[model samples]
Target: MKELIISSINDNLNNAVALLDAIDSKTYSDDSIGPYYSSIGSHIRHTLDFFDCIISGIDTNDIDLTARKRDEILSTNKEAAKSHIHTLQGTLLSYIDANTDYLIHVTDNMGQGKVTVNYTLESILAHANSHAIHHYATIGYILNQLGIDLKIPGFGYNPTTPVNKREGI
Candidate 1:
């Protein structure tokens, strides 16, 4: 189970790296995408920040989802974003054999107010993976609007999603 979870998260992170490699700083930082007006770089940074939170709180056993870095450089510079992602990848690799099923306290706001709840490290990692994919889908939309192709197969789709239903499939 640990291996499976790690592999899945690695795949998503790799997908993000591939995307960063393909696009330039201009496209990455472009926030003119309409509606939400969020940029690819912003989405990428936000996704990574989730994992950063996990890494930050894992040692102390108190994961706070709200404690995001939200660094502007990460959301405006492609190279910085790539560097951050690589750092996170290295950190995750170091935890491959760690006790993922161990209980941890997670704090996040569902709607009303901030609340702390018990959750396994594995569960939090899984949730972060799914959260990354959700943001990837949004990034995919931004890429399409910018007339750019990810060129990476299944870049923004969940594994359980039907292949036939995937965009550009």
Candidate 2:
């Protein structure tokens, strides 16, 4: 189970890595898109931040999802984003076959106020996987606006999505 969970997390993280490698710095940092005005780098950084929080809290068993590094370099520099991706991938490798039964205290806001909920390591990993997929979809849109083709089929589609309906299908 731990191996499967780690693999799932790494899959999405790898997708971000591939994207960072494919785009230039200008495309990465561009926030000129209307409506939200967010860049692909922003989405990548935000997606990785959740994994960062989870990994940083592993030793203490206290994960704070609301607390993020928000590193500017990650949201601007393509190389920096790629480096962070490598770091996260390596960090996740260490957790393969780890004890997923350990209890993890997750801290996050739920409309009313901040809440600390208990979850198994596996469960939190699952949530992080889903979170990454959601952010990747947004990044895909950003890439589309910039006219940058990642050429990665199903880059942002859910695994269970019908094959014919997928973006790159």
Task: Indicate which candidate wins on lDDT.
Answer: 1
**Model 2 agreement with the true structure over 54-95: per-residue lDDT tens digits:** 998888988998899999888998898888888888888898
lDDT of each: 0.88, 0.83
**Clash counts for the predictions, in order:** 0, 0
Pairing residues by index, what is the TM-score of model 1? 0.95
Error of 1 at 26 (Å): 0.3
For model 1, how does the per-residue alpha-carbon lDDT over 33-148 read when each residue is reduced to its tens digit? 99999999999989989999999999999999999989989999998888988888888888888866668999999899999999887789899999999999999899899888
Off by over 4 Å in 1: 167-169
User: In model 2, which runs have C-alpha deviations exceeding 4 angstroms?
Assistant: none
lDDT value, residue 161 of candidate 2: 90
Cα lDDT over the full model 1 = 0.88
True-structure RMSD for candidate 2:
1.5
